[model samples]
Target: MPKSIKQINEKIKKGRAVIVRADEVPELSEKYGTKKTAEKIDIITCATFGAMCSSGAILNFGHTEPPIKIQKLWLNDVEAYAGLAAVDAYLGATEESLDRGIEYGGAHVIEDLISGKKINIKAQAHGTDCYPRKLLESSFTLKDLNQATLYNPRNAYQRYNAATNSSPNTLYTYMGTLLPQLGNINYSGTGELSPLNNDPSYRTLGLGSRIFLGGAQGYI
Candidate 1:
């Protein structure tokens, strides 16, 4: 008999559902026939050893005693956009600092903050009567911030295209190092655990779906 949605959910809640890997379907099918395997399996898990995903974070520094519009901002040497508000800014994972290349980026700063390490927060502003502060520099940890959350506008892409260079010289692109004369092809995303790949027609996964984001439970 086919299991109902409620029954399947109950089995999952009780940890009694049989979990299977996508790659093991063939072996399991041979062992217990396709029908029997389908009846027994409740969940399928996909695996991708390495997958490149774009992500970023937003940080709110809360209100300062004397509010000043930030004209320039830098977090851990990485330039962050501060045009949203006086105390709001966003940091991207792949953003490179003007002083320090990719050696220290927003992703590294976020990791350090998560690990309870202090990071430098510097800002410059034009002095005003209400807010006379022209420059400010301080060190702050994640706990010190009013709010910090990952806000990746585009996380897992539905699909991606591969790239190759036909130029005579090598090219250093975001896609990765491209060899000269179409020597090698570059591709990103492994398809495993991708929301779109699993739900091609977008039936089960939809708005407000729970997702694992940056080691935390979030919703899409």
Candidate 2:
């Protein structure tokens, strides 16, 4: 039976769906044939992702007593963009911290926050008539924030670019240090568990596609 995603979703809701892992597709296809395998499976979980698919967090610090509009924000010594709202800021994973250097960044801050560790908070704002506050220095944990949302705009690509160094001397890059003369070829994404690879034709994927993002249920 040719089952559309809508049909599969209906089956899933009614407890009639059969799900399998992406890696299991080959064996099942060999055992039952491609057509039968396709008919039997309602969902194939493509369990994959990589650190290269770096993401960020949107944090709502909530309002302070007679809050001032924040112009600059820092979390755990990492500068977070606070141009959005009064207390809302975004902590990017790749953002480097002044104190920790490149070794520690927004990702570490997020990890620390999730681990229930205290993070230093600092902000500067111009005082207003109703909100008369200028400098705000504080500390917070993950629970302290009104909302912390994991917002990932980047994902591992199916056909990612390969980086290589052809120069006589070593070259340094964001991917890592590359030796000269093609000493290393860094493939950004290997396609394993990539949604595009799992659904090559994008058959079942569309607007509002459900996914597990950072271990949380989310949608595209």
Candidate 3:
């Protein structure tokens, strides 16, 4: 007989339930009946290694005694969007430096900050009565920020199609360089490692599922 929810909970609490990848379901199902197999499996994990995940971090520098409404901001030479408030901005992983181009981006800045490296912070603003400072330049590490957290708008992709160029000119895109005249085809994720390929129906992996993200545990 299939186990009830209570029984499953008890088994999980007592460390008796088995955990396996989604791909192993067929083999386990053959050995045990489908109903019994479902009861035995406690968790299923699906992974996508090479997905083009756009990630970023929102950092808030505590308000200064005399605040200034920032019009422009730069973190470690990479420009960050600062239209939210006086001391709040978001730095994207793919954001490139205006002076240095793609050599340095928000991802590198984040990595440097995490490693306890001091990063240059430059801000410019028009002076006001309540916020009098016009120009400010400082250096800060991760410890100096009030809040810093990764906030990625789009991370995992269920599926994607291949891309190729038919035009006579080279095209540069987020998917990388495309040679002229369909010389090469570009694909994103590996078939075996795709999350959608492993869990086609979203059985165990869905909303509120626990996941490993950025060297820590997170939820989707």
Candidate 4:
């Protein structure tokens, strides 16, 4: 038997629908068989994870007594794109620090900002009539900024596979160290809990769907 989303939603409104985690669906289906399990469950809450690389944040540094149009920008030694509006810039998570290489970058900078740690802000600008300042160097935290919006282009994978290296030398990866000649295996994703897998047909999610990103409410 098939259950329409409307029917499930009706049960939910009446507080009679049964909700379960996506991780539990496999076991439940095995215990009671797929048909019975499907009838018993009305909603599945999906929460998935994987190595996220295509992610970044847009930040607004507010303004100073003499506002500057940032032309070149860096946050905590990690470069950011400042081609947007006057006081705003986009910081990519994978942007490596100028001297720290892979050790520290935009991701760490964002974390430090969120932790209320001081972040060194640097920028250069062409003096303008309205925004005349040509250079900026200062320190601030998350609270000191007008806005810090984390916008990841890719997140919550539908499915992902384990990683392995077949080379003779060790490989450094975001997933972790991949040993030589397939000596070790690294993987990502939380299996069925992945959003798309829970509703492969786009039954419960869409363009305007809302989700919680980093414990903050966001939309798709």
Candidate 5:
């Protein structure tokens, strides 16, 4: 049976951290000034967002402003299990589970999407340290699912489950660790809007649950 909004809301009220997966494009041509190609690009963009079908787990809404934290993870392979697989790999990277609570919560949330609601998000708590800095003030309104908020299936997994399309739940996780250690990406640049330099909008966006069950790549 499909889980009602009430059931999902109840979980959130009980302090269950959610994992919301925003749709990501394989490239950020406009942001990087690259042309559309047969392959993926280095960074993702705001335009290539899958907001409509992407799932969301509302933490709490009674606050003056909805606060949400989003953490992004990138994998080398876009086809791998980002949530489950990545979580297992990053376990040893940290000594404390709360510090690693994001991964655990993320994996469980993704599994919830696959297995449907009726699962427990309470036991998967990470001590509530990582909360989104803001709520999703999406461009989409009740009028209709705007094109800006439409969900696009960029891969096979999405294509198969078109009927049950929904936003992902929100959670926490780690990212960018390998970027510094691997040297695959460069953190030395100051652009008009760059996360590395702490762009206001970008930093304020904070982290989300582990949505990238795949891997991240770079262009030489």
Candidate 6:
């Protein structure tokens, strides 16, 4: 079951930490007959990863080794997972919805509820698409590795799958209260990554663990 913002806030205030299990599993089944026999059942396995979030840190625990090719632009699965978790902790810690800026607490609660592993994975992928621009623009030199701006550079990017490129999904841009006033958030044109695809650069970052936490700022 999903947790409420109030509940999550209390936990955070009390220094509550959670491990999010993103592993996709097969649906279980049960059988009943005239004999009324119950037996163990086996099912299929699916792809999924684990995520952990705390007031101070976030961790992405997975069976497979994360791909971290470029030291400058790439964000490992653990960093991606932690970054998103930190964002969520920031949101939950703020508790802005209690103010008059919000009319419906449910909306704020729902928004908080949806910010999880699924969104984290997507956001990580978006970060992957934006890595090149981030590296080129940041102060960190590719040669001298001192300041690690690669942790969370405040940027965003998106692209559609090749099969659906002709039609294309809704053009996405990064918009958040925490996000600085940079124009790098767009699908294309006027400060955007043009021609999106499942590029190898994304792989260089990692297997694309994307995360997203969406909503108008100041509301919640």
lDDT of 1: 0.77
Better by TM-score, candidate 3 or 1: 1
Name the lDDT of candidate 3.
0.78
Poorest 10 consecutive residues by lDDT, candidate 5: 73-82
Sequence-dependent TM-score of model 4: 0.81
lDDT of 6 by residue, 133-171 (tens): 112121212122221111222122323212112222333
lDDT of 2: 0.82
In candidate 1, what are the lDDT values of residues 1-220, reduced to their tens digit?
A: 7777688789989989888767677799999999999898987765333334466778888756677677788988888888787778888777787787977777788778788999998988886887677787888998888988886555546357588999999999868999999999988655555556666787656778776666677777
- lDDT over C-alpha atoms for residue 200 of model 3: 67
lDDT of 6: 0.25
Worst 10-residue lDDT window for candidate 4 reads 152-161
Q: What's the TM-score of each model vs. the native?
A: 0.79, 0.81, 0.72, 0.81, 0.18, 0.18
Please give the distance, in angstroms, between residue 1's alpha carbon in candidate 3 and its true position after superposition. 9.4
Give the 10-residue window scoring lowest on summed lDDT in candidate 3: 44-53
lDDT of each: 0.77, 0.82, 0.78, 0.86, 0.27, 0.25
Each candidate's number of clashing pairs is 0, 0, 0, 0, 28, 14
Candidate 2: stretches off by over 4 Å: 26-40, 156-158
Query: What alpha-carbon RMSD in Å does predicted model 5 have with respect to the real structure?
Result: 22.5
Q: State the number of backbone clashes in model 6.
A: 14
lDDT of 5 by residue, 21-132 (tens): 1122223434444344213222232211121232322121121232333222211111111133212212111122243443544334333333433322111112233443
Q: 66, model 3: CA deviation in Å?
A: 3.6
Using lDDT as the measure, name the better of candidate 2 and candidate 6.
2
Alpha-carbon RMSD of each model: 3.3, 2.9, 4.2, 2.9, 22.5, 22.2
**Per-residue lDDT of model 4, residues 99-130, tens digit only:** 99989998899788778899999999999999
Error in Å for residue 171 of model 6: 23
Tens digits of lDDT, candidate 2, 1-220: 6778788889989999998887788899999999999988988888555555458999999889878788898888899999898888989998999888989999989889888899999999988886688888999887888999887666634446578999999988866788999999876653545667767787777768888766678887
lDDT of 6 at 5: 47
Candidate order, lDDT descending: 4, 2, 3, 1, 5, 6
TM-score, structure 5 vs. true: 0.18
